[model samples]
Target: MIKNAIYLLFSFFIIGCVSTKSTLKNVDYKATKPKIEKGKYVITEYANDPKYGYNKEYPINIGFANLHSEEYFVKLFFNGLTNPEGDIFSYEKIETCCPFPSNHNKMGVGLLHKYRVTFNNGTTKDLYINLYEKGEILCPNGFKILAN
Candidate 1:
């Protein structure tokens, strides 16, 4: 019984890491603040202004080569991000949907999203919105927001 129970738990954890349609879709975005091109990423900034806040504090996300795809490529740009001056920007994984919370130990879903990135010259920041099929511009020139 103990071995069976442990196996069940492990299976659930593995399943939970796969993000499905509903999980990655449907994030709310602000109309006033639009997506912009900053460094090698096109991202939507977390509106810091109180009037446009999401009532949540999260890091600005950046996107690599997989910004405009429906399939989760699970890869990053080999040549990391750089600036107009050729300085390489650095990033830290601030958050991860790592060990996802399950619903009744079934129907598990989660995604690895959210990050903190600092651009050269320290000019702009924002996060990569991973909701697919919405025509978000590919990083480097494409950024978009959740439609109203």
Candidate 2:
């Protein structure tokens, strides 16, 4: 009887600690609807909220002109973490302000990128990135809001 009681207690404790990781797969970001900024860059949650003391690294894909080769092909992957408040965020991906070449689609477009990010509640957010250049780069904020 004592052994059974102990087992029951242990099982209950373990169940309480069990939790699920953050997976953006099948997550309806569209339903949530991202907040677009001035018809430019769009900001949205990474699925997992990494606020407070909890933090996780997310990966990003960067493509640009290879200055060395004088060609337009470059790829980089890196991990970045979220801020404490969850409002502020940063990634290892390179943020470029320069103009993309005319033939950027040949290299920069149609790339499937993946990143494993952790959230505030010990959950992980898997990010898939798809990059491209739109129109004639209107202004500094011409990047435009990327629709999911």
Candidate 3:
């Protein structure tokens, strides 16, 4: 119980430090959710900008509002991608960083979830995800959209 309390307090303290303005560059409130098939998101476009998802300022904004779990959306998003050579990929959330203001959360702030994606060929890259806002779902550079 003490550990849980300490964690909660630490979380509050971190959230309290968020800036009043968000720095995310890709949040689109009018963006529509991607279609899901075979437990994966159906992504058709590749991000033209190299910084998309790979930079903290341009996280892949998969909003949590219409979903039950933010992690579920993260999985679906990754599941729809593969290496350029069509090799399957695996990913894990390695860290949460880059707090920013967002009205979507009860704390009025949100943090970016950084994921480490590993391809079958032993290559890895870090991608940042934002759960507090919506944006176009696209395959990042160095990756391809899984065929439907």
lDDT of 2: 0.29
TM-score leader: 3
lDDT of 1 by residue, 64-112 (tens): 2233441223223202234545565655545544333323223443334
- Model 3 C-alpha lDDT per residue in residues 50-89, reported as the tens digit of each score: 9999999999988865335867888889889889999888
Indicate the TM-score of model 1: 0.34
**Which has the higher TM-score value, candidate number 2 or candidate number 3?**
3
The lDDT, on a scale of 0 to 1, for candidate 1 is 0.35
Residue lDDT tens for model 2, 53-137: 1211221222232344211111121112233433322222223222222234432212223333444455444443323221111
Regions more than 4 Å wrong, model 1: 1-75, 78-80, 97-107, 129-137, 140-148
**Total backbone collisions, model 1:** 4
Question: What is the full ranking by TM-score, best candidate first?
Answer: 3, 1, 2
RMSD to truth, every model: 9.8, 18.6, 2.1
Q: In terms of TM-score, which candidate is stronger, 1 or 3?
A: 3
True-structure lDDT of candidate 3: 0.88
